[model samples]
Target: MGALMLKEIRSFLNSITGYLVIVVYLLINSFLLWMFPGVFNILEGSYASIDSLFLVSPWVFMFLIPAITMRMFADEKKAGTMELLLTRPVTDMQIVLSKFSAGFILVLFSILPTLIYYVSVYQLGNPVGNIDNGGAFGSYIGLLFLGASYVSIGVFASSLTENQIVAFLIGVFLCLFMYIGFEQMSELNLFGNADLFILSMGISEHYTSMSRGVLDSRDMLYFISLIVFFSLATRLVIQSRKW
Candidate 1:
């Protein structure tokens, strides 16, 4: 499993695609946080916070993660190597997890460079570190879990198709739906007082809750459930080939 995971990670880093994804993610965020003169600019905000980053990154990952995981299983199937892979000693669960972990770690790497934004904000704070450390920390944690959820979703989407493009589109749709579709549904008033409950089912609700640095166990559980659900779903998708 570890070898397979490493192979996926290496395949990413060895190709221009991996570097391109990281560069694009950082460049967009850096522009919004530092260069662009707007509400998202750190200089324009009154408070010392990378809130703009937390706000913008989810949107970026909505596309970026799909690109990262699009080829995970799709390429294997396209090359007719999935049969060879399945014949290996690993279980379907391990294969799915290895790909998911590699994709998720890449997401983490993409986010790591953004810590420079945090350092910059910390120094620029009026009292030289007067920023809301708790909230900032919480938001970062929330972002990791959010990215993990996306990766799991992407991995499952990849298993659904042999064409990487289809997988990418499907992954993006799933990520976007989980991120905001539920919130929109709740706004329609279809559920009455249950509207809030419906809204809570989306990723945004739990992500926002954790962004406050509250670290609610329920929010963590929701993210874990999402990751688990998709991981298992991917495994099932792979196993279906046996029948």
Candidate 2:
């Protein structure tokens, strides 16, 4: 399992995929927060808050993470190596987890550099370091959880198709729906008294809670459960070949 995980990470690093993910992620964020002339630009907002980064990052991850994980299993099957991989001593769950871990690590790499934005915001504050450290820290944690959940979803999508494009589309659709669809549905009052319940089912609700600097157990549990659910689903997809 460890070897498989390392191999997956090494594959990402050896190719342009790893660098591309990190570079593009940082570039987009930097542009939105600095260079871009819009509400996302910190200078235009004239507020020493990195709220725009948190606001825009989820949408960015919706596409970027899928691209990162699109070829995890899809490329394996495409190259006819999936059979060889299955025949290895590792369990299907291990295989799924290895890919998921590699993708999540790549996501982390993309996120770490964004800390510079935080530092910049901190210093830009009137009193220097007057920024809301608690909220900023919480938002970073929320991003980690959000990224992990997207990775799991992407891994599952990849396991379902040998075509990387199809996997990428599926991953993006699923991530978008999970992140916002439930909240949008609730706004329609379709569930009546159950509207709040329905709204709570989406990632947006929990993510919002965390963004407010509150680490609720339920929010943490929701993210963990979402990740586990998709990981298991991917494992099952991998195991289906046996049947």
RMSD of each: 0.8, 1.0
Regions of model 1 farther than 4 Å from truth: none
Write out the backbone clash pairs for model 1: none
| lDDT per residue (tens digit) for residues 1-243 in model 1 | 999999999999999999999999999999988999998999999888899998998999999999999999999999999999999999899999999999999999999999999999999999999899999999999999999999999999999999999999999999999999999999998999999899999999999888878799999999999999999999999999999
Candidate closest to the true structure, highest lDDT: 1
- lDDT against the true structure, per candidate, is 0.95, 0.93
The candidate 2 region of ten consecutive residues with least summed lDDT is 39-48
Clashes of 2: 0
Best by TM-score: 1
Model 2 TM-score relative to the real fold:
0.97
Evaluated against the true structure, the overall lDDT of model 2 is: 0.93
